[model samples]
Target: MNHPPLAGHPADTGLELCEGSALQERGLAVSFDIQLWDHPARAFALRFDGRPVAYVNRCAHVPAEMDWQPDHFLDDSGEWIMCAIHGAIYDPRDGRCAGGPCPGGKLIEVKVDERDGKVYWYPSADVQPAFPD
Candidate 1:
């Protein structure tokens, strides 16, 4: 249940994810390891509309990884997050299920913030850092 220390930010600040420049607009996501309810899992962060968005890599339709290729979440149009397994499309801005299977479902969102040239993802009660500080 331990978390990393926020060196320059507040004690409630999120864990350091990556450099701000690492996420390109509508491009490959920056993947990272996490512990979801004490189980190992993966999460990803990407830039859309000049802002950062993140979500657990699991699709809502099924507890399966959604990326077609490593770090490749967005579809060919680069407008939505598409699951390679069930073909569920999600809005990257909010992780809402937009089309295909799993209607009315939503991806597990991972809160994120960008500041001081870095991106950080918040750890929740259920989601935690894989490697504690």
Candidate 2:
């Protein structure tokens, strides 16, 4: 698969966090629940076997973040990412809705790629491409 070029962006976004990797080798899941855009949009970064994966935190059914707390979006089992508001479960591998209110509903995928071993989001990491009132 093709990934984006990581040029200039913060070390962390709502979607992911740097796990103290100078080369950005690893990424820890982060909660964007704090920064709720008008659209409740949040970006995340994930690294699987050194591959970069970035996606928005918004669910497909309703406009909400997939986190119960800051950087605590994963379930207690740490198996799948979950939405505390509606009990939705998502596969971290593909962001596909595996369970919950909308069984088939999936989280929106945000575009991001890795460059020089670091992850990055497009239009910037704030996810505030359009300011909300």
Candidate 3:
């Protein structure tokens, strides 16, 4: 697969994820694609108490995507992030496993920032933006 060039260098620049209002309108959760360890990976962002939070899309219990549907991460009450596959609940603020099968396990966190009307997620040494094949 061909991937697009990363928005910016992970060390210096932040990748623009989405508009702040758009996330807010969508109950504060949205999905985006990135490169993790040189492989295609999915991630999601959420707003917890008006703050932006993000995590790798994979579940800690089992290395599987957690969203119930495309970009859907929150439960009905929109209070916690739930894994659609195993009923695992996670704390949106810190990606901690609040209650679920993956005890003492937490979702991988991706650094994110919401500023100037847009949301930006940062890549670390292990995670980077995916490029076209």
Candidate 4:
């Protein structure tokens, strides 16, 4: 019943709902500065991979958002995550930019963790590099 608070969640503030469950998590969004992508950039964070790994959520070429919806990020193939804004395909396994204008570009990996049954996104860094330090 005791855990740290998700005070720095990028999406919103204080216990944001992710994949909803009865569990209570403790963490925050890394991109807490901006609610939405300004120019369809890549950003990865709020991961369930033990710690958190987030990116800009953008494609290097067009520099667009991978998801069509606000937070609805995923690829048409589903096997790989795609950028909805510019059709950039990437490997969800590592957030690596696979196909699209920026062939060499990669998907920014989001960092996160699940203490109980809730998911939390890491806060954006002071600078830019995709994942946190």
lDDT per residue, candidate 2, 44-130, as tens digits?
A: 655544555556767666876656765456677666777878888887677788888767776665555555444445443334343
- Backbone N/Cα/C clashes per model: 0, 3, 6, 51
Q: Quote the positional error of residue 40 for candidate 1 in Å.
A: 0.4
Per-candidate TM-score against the hidden true structure: 0.90, 0.60, 0.87, 0.52
Please report the candidate that would top TM-score against the real structure: 1
Tens-place lDDT digits, model 4, residues 1-133: 2223335554343233354242212123233322232222344444333444455656666755555665445544445556666677766557777777667776554455545555565443322223232
Q: Per-residue alpha-carbon lDDT of model 1 for 8-116, expressed as tens digits?
A: 5532788899999999999999999998877899999999999999999999999999999999999999999999997999999899999999799999999999999
Window of ten residues with lowest summed lDDT in model 4: 20-29
Model 1 segments more than 4 A misplaced: 1-11
Clashing pairs in 2: 15-43, 15-44, 15-45
Indicate the residue-level lDDT of 132 in model 3: 56
Best by lDDT: 1
Q: List the residue pairs that clash in candidate 3.
A: 1-133, 2-132, 2-133, 3-131, 3-132, 3-133
Could you arrange the candidates by TM-score from highest to lowest? 1, 3, 2, 4
lDDT of 4: 0.47
- Work out candidate 3's RMSD over C-alphas: 3.5
